[model samples]
Target: MTETLADFRRRVADFLAHHGCPAGAAPSRSRRPADHVAAARVHQRALADAGLAGITWPVEVGGLGLGPEYRQAFAEESAGFETFSAVFTIGLGMCGPVLLALGTADQRSRYLPPLLRADEVWCQLFSEPGAGSDLAGLTTTAVPDDDGGWRIRGQKVWTTYAHHSDRALLLARTDPGKAKHRGITMFVLDMTAPGVTVRPLRQATGDAEFNEVFLDDVRVGPDDVVGAVDEGWRAATLMLMNERVALADNPIGSPVTLDAVVALANRTGRTTDPVVRKAVADAYVAQQQAELFARRIAGEVRVGRDPGALASIGKLAAGRLATQVSALALEVAGPDAVAWDPADPDGGLWAYGELYAPSLSIAGGTEQIQRTVLGERVLGLPREPQADRDVPFRELRRG
Candidate 1:
């Protein structure tokens, strides 16, 4: 007795309309992060009440025990509206998946229900000052305590929404004597723990969408450990793969950016400029290509295909296309693109996109890393030589 896709879509649409979810325009001022979280909690509560929030999750954890196609349909239809549920992206995207894949039965029972209902928020605590791309080379340490728990001490940077997170899925070295990747363990750390501190990092766009977190002797019980000790790297890889796939599928674009750029070109009397027209056309083409690739990747995931290197392809294309589209938006806007004053209200959208373009190549995964992954894992290229691959983490050179 499963609901048909069309029926589920109609139910979602009707529920959204009844709740006054924004349909066309960008989310209103009430849709700020804090507000968005609150709204998402409300919406998720309704969704759970209607048995729709975790469409692809198991029924034991309050899901419908449905397939990925149902989740894909939900995402597609949800993208057509301006919903506040995006505030839970990190929770639903990275943390939830990691928990589902690696969490023990007790851990899953304790965490998944609230997560599916958006009652709690989660963030990833993985990247460190020396670790990002070479994540296995992280220096964070977790020592076992007499109380049958662990004391964690470390820093994680580029943590999205750590400032608002209720919990973090953290990675730390449990055995420095083991090889770099073999010594690590993943734990669920309470963000409200006494020594947990968060500082929002302001980006060029003037938004503190990311944060830096410092953990000082934060104690976590044995029950918090996810997967096997020293097996965090595998869990992390799975999460990163999911992250690449989800980021590639992010529906951040609007017809507005292109429309605004076109209007600006016509207003500046540059619509006839051959170079400008070509840039616009090329940008459109790139967007179409990226979208098609993303759609294909989404289809693979819907049918339960492990995307593997295909996710890298989508991520790489997304990064390149973002840069190209943003550059074209700036070109179309001409002189007006120099400043990112949203108050200007006319051409500010183009300027904002241009200003934010550089981040696309770095966020989720760097373009270089994406290409390396694609080449090695996808194309069966020779593996990169690593001096530290078999070295003990404690004996490795710090610099």
Candidate 2:
């Protein structure tokens, strides 16, 4: 029997009320990464037990095998409450989707169940020292071993939560003799393997939410390869598309809302200023616009349609909106935002949001990258001329 949307919404709301963290219950940004991960695992296990997690995944992998609309409904219902989803965002939203789309049957069966229940965590190993914006130009190398496996050696920077991840979807150059993009391969890397090192990178927000990873001849079995060898670009493209959508639909990390910003304005007596009022109004409208666009993109995915460039649009809007809302909150916070009393622990929320705002634009995909995708992919514009597009990666100049 198919459950109606209203019934699903009620079920989600009831579950969240019992198990969800109330909005503003804690300063999420101030929480340690390990603390967040621990709480999220607990929350996810409970949600999975109640058939709320993996709302759109297949039944064979312990999901309810529901439609995408159910997932969308859950997102809408759970938006106001902190579901502790940040820790598993890369696993569930990005890696899980990629595995589902291109993974072998064995890979899907082995990984998806644990991921849905938050029994494991995942991260992405795509951004390298040389491949932040130009991911295809990465220098990471995976050499074939005598055991029919591979040994990876490279560095990946800005890896979110690598310190705690159980696995990661890694991209490396398997055939540098081919063109940069054509030579790449994706693998499911075991984070606990030998020669793998994770070093946390403390951001300006005083949070170690990102990390830089080093792989010193880390061994990966043939079973760990995702998609076909030397053809990972297709799988990578799918993941990136899903990443933009996920970043849009799910505010994975600690996100500040307009309501909180407005309340700060009211408390600080800034609401009376004409300029402040106008900025608040503008922020509200922008929030609505971004939300509506996200919903539209979700609808397309619900029907099994690829969002493609539309995901980029939502991502761009979300990135801009994060900065706009957080900046407004900081402005309203005035002196307290800069230096709050030590006794008042929550007083620095606005400051944290302000510092975290810049990363929102930079993460997932940059504003400039998103715009380039939109212009070239959506508007049917001419492709950017890369002088090294057809050149072999081994022969390319290094920084």
Candidate 3:
């Protein structure tokens, strides 16, 4: 007999209770970055061994082969724990899912098991310096070699956890003679390969959560190719959709909750202020609305239906909620929010989040990009004017 969802949730809660990482719900506590990553990997491996890592994935891929309900139970049970799984999010949530969808059977069998077990880490190499929103305009080039492999050369920016990655899901120009989107190909490249470099990028939050990756003639085998050579645009779009799901979905822990913000306000003696109280209420409603949108999208995906353009709705809404909650944290924390003394009781917790909140609108596709996508694809509005739609990428001027 199969284990039920309720039983699985209880088991997860028991495991989390015994996990020796950290205990309280405090967010201000900081640990060394390397330590956090290592701890996350170990915890992730333990989850894999327990058949709790990839809840909705196939057993062949080291998953429980259950469904979204099981996954939901695990997430709900584990949310209150002081776990560090950030390092695995891009891999298991975004890259792993996309590879499962687009990769060959050989590729899936070779990669998915190790990935699920946290034996390796992955990063997405999509955004380039000049191609942030217009990702197809990326200039990364992968040329075919006599050895039947491809030599990649380019730089990717805003790559999360790239400095700690084992492999990268890469998009490079393979046939520039074709249209911009048509000429691209997706390849899985070894991050530690010769001539590849990863540089830590400190964000406004004063943490190195992102990296700049440079690939100088990094080589990958034919088996590394995902989808057809020039059909990468399709795979890339699908990957972006998966990324939206990962970003918007509230599985695992939430970004930050309205309750936390209200509690902070109460702690700082702002709860009696009418304006502050109203802001708290408004933030709560926005969060609930976004949560509902995310749940709807996840349900659609669980039922084998594509979110298509609607994923943008979730991403945009979540981003807005994050920004709002973070701003509230700053407001409620008062002057101590920005300038914190160890003497301050709140411990300057909200400061880091306030700085980090602005990026929510920028990452995983910007708010502007999401709105444009929604307008053209979801709302049936006309696409923005493009004179180069028919022009071959080779003939177009690139800045």
Clashes of each: 0, 0, 0
Cα deviation of 258 in candidate 2 (Å)? Answer: 2.5
Q: Which stretches of model 1 miss by more than 4 angstroms? A: 23-31, 83-86, 248-256, 266-269, 340-343
**TM-score of candidate 1 versus the correct structure, residues matched by position:** 0.92
lDDT of 1 by residue, 318-337 (tens): 66776777777777666777
Candidate 3 ranges beyond 4 A from true positions: 1-14, 20-31, 82-85, 251-257, 342-346
TM-score of each: 0.92, 0.93, 0.90
Could you tell which candidate, 2 or 3, scores higher by TM-score?
A: 2
Ranking the candidates on TM-score from highest down gives 2, 1, 3
Candidate 1 vs. truth: CA RMSD? 2.5
For TM-score, the strongest prediction is: 2
Candidate 1 whole-model C-alpha lDDT, 0 to 1: 0.78
Q: Write the per-residue lDDT of candidate 3 for residues 1-399, one digit (tens) a residue.
A: 778877887888777766635534323323367766777788788877766778888888788888777766765576546545466668988889888888999989999998988789898899999899899998999999998889999999999889888988999999989989899999998899998999989887788878899989888998889999988899988887776566544433234567777877766688789888888889889989987877888777665567788887776776778778888877777777778777765465677666666776777778898889888887889887896786889898878
Worst 10 residues of 3 by lDDT: 22-31
The better-scoring model by TM-score among 1 and 2 is 2
RMSD of each: 2.5, 2.1, 2.7
